[model samples]
Target: MSEYIPLKYYFDRDLALHLADLIQSEYPRFTITSFVESVSTGVENKELKARVEVIANTLKQHLPTDYEEALAILLKILGPENKTEEGMFTNGYFLMPVAYFVERYGLDHFDLSLHAMYEITKRHTSEYAIRPYLIANSDRCMTYFQNWIKDPNSHVRRLVSEGTRPRLPWAKKIPPLKNDVQNNLSLLEKLMCDSSRYVQKSVANHINDLTKDNPEAVLTWIQKHISDNHGTNPKIIKHGLRTLIKSKDEHALELSRQVEQGV
Candidate 1:
């Protein structure tokens, strides 16, 4: 077999060098030597997210302390928006730490960080980074989400759903989001018929997340959204109710059967 590489290896020394060079290109005064040195120390041993955290933390130390100034520098480094939906991890791998940097430090500045997410998510993903916005200001965050659902960029539209997942993997749970089921469903209603499969998956996953504790509410939603003109709605319900189906839930199985029949 060809030599195997670990997933964590993506955040390796070469990645650090590449990331440092990219930032240095945008902000000439960025100290490349110091940034890379700090990021490379024992980074290989840490797990995936830890590596991202280490780099993000190091960036905070090396860059200006003021959040907006540091964000300005970070923004300059995001070269262009990723037009395709599929290549976020491949084309935008370098931005993992950059997005994390925003998640870790940008929570305090609502509008600034929210705007930063809009810009960065188009290139990479602000999925995990954007959660704090929901936590810190649910109403304000919802206002932003309202606009994001209609956003022309697929990634921005995905963020409106993916970013608000109740128990989004690799990120901490947002209790408010988990508890506020109706508001969450309202947002999902808009995205259920999204053109992008990328957005569709997030919308489905968001609904699936709701089924964990709010199964009845999700069932109610399925009752309302599903019909003969199913479109992708049945698949959305089937995936969302998969957990319940395996447990032999009567209604969930019925819905799965409906999906199979394309009704």
Candidate 2:
């Protein structure tokens, strides 16, 4: 009957109902009764870690076969928050589904997960899960990215930067980006001026991650786009300059000073 119990105990009918009630309280507008029931029936209630893994695997299995339906269920279950009432939900609950969607439909059915990703990422922006969805199907994702960069929805464009992050959480590390990271900066080349604060943050993080392997490239980006994005946005300035500051690079320091002086 705990507020924050592990997934391993979901099999106990009493425990499942209690946990479901707590989650329902958190998200009164949306209900996850079916998923909770499915979890309760599954043997995942034995070992916590194993149970979570099983759920992740199950979601993965479902993605390729019946993605539209599966994604619908996932998005509905995740629900909205106060500030934004969309498919925003807890990161932990969506991890398995995200991972599964990436593995199953990332190649042939990018659209199947793309819409759902746009929704779930509003709340659970796990870098780990987003990375594979981008890398495994970079070409396909890029096709969508081409269309999304200009779409009215900032959430879609945010995925452009977020999905390609090198050190994204729970995802495998892409060494190519990590090594000559600057090469990958083109992914967000057009997103620098995205109107959404959330989308802009993802753009900044993309630049921040690149700085580790390519300081010069990041510097060039900042300098070239300085007039365009430097002074106006805090996220761009901060994330773009993170590496230079961390390395104590001289030019970066000068730029920081300039931004400060402008302020």
Candidate 3:
């Protein structure tokens, strides 16, 4: 069990319940079931996403500054069952509260909430909702990324990339990281060969995002990093080279052609 922290002790339970009720009333169709069904189908609109943001903000007001309690609440709402097929839409609805608390409070603890949040969002199949919190704490976000890279869980490993994606859909871009792409790229390097396909996708997306501003840097890294002994980790390969392929860069094009030939 995780340690206890009085982080959310100051929050008003009534307010938290009120907010959850309001979300249900406002978006009657926004149940855990519906959310799970829609995860792969794509988000309905910004309005709904915004509503989630509203709930998150409300939760923020209630979150205790301590790390453990914050994570306890997040996990409580977004627990293991939500990640299963039986709990499809369950995960999406709970994300609002978890996101709310993380963004509102500071990330000052042993970074416990950071890890738990990453685990919760990892299965969501979309990172847009979590980007706000990630960007808001970008100054300290690197540490979260560094620690997650070596996590035993594949979901946590991918959070390192997905959470920091520059142009993640539904998310506003964070300019400083975009300007100095290396910081993000360097982090992705740790998970380039992650065992999980989900993680590889994130790594590729991170690389793709960097390719727009620094194609040469990405190309050099891929050449130096990709391995022959890794077998067929196409998800990682595709994500790692996504930007180059999209831009029709010379090397990227050649690799695509090779992939097609091999197929």
Better of 1 and 2 by lDDT: 1
For candidate 1, write residues 91-151 as lDDT tens digits. Answer: 8888989899988898778888899889989998999998877777788988888898999
Question: Where does model 3 exceed 4 Å of error?
Answer: 1-46, 60-75, 81-90, 107-112, 122-139, 176-179, 226-235, 238-243, 257-263
What's the lDDT for all of these models?
0.84, 0.59, 0.56
Q: What is the TM-score of each candidate against the true structure?
A: 0.92, 0.65, 0.63
Alpha carbon lDDT at 154, candidate 2: 61
lDDT (tens digit, per residue) of candidate 3 on 1-263: 97774323212333345445544444343343333333312322334554455446544434444456545655554435233322223335445545545544534542665655665665443244346555556766676667777977676666667767876766777653535777776787677667776677667777777777677777766655543332435566566677677767788776555544444
Sort all candidates by TM-score, best to worst. Answer: 1, 2, 3
Error of 1 at 137 (Å): 1.0
Model 1 residue runs over 4 Å out of place are 1-4, 42-44, 176-178, 227-232, 259-263
Q: Which pairs clash (backbone N, Cα, C closer than 3 Å) in model 1? A: none
Model 2 alpha-carbon drift over 4 Å, by segment: 1-52, 59-108, 119-130, 175-183, 227-235
lDDT agreement of model 1 with the native = 0.84
Candidate 2, clashing residue pairs? 60-100, 127-169, 128-168, 128-169, 128-171
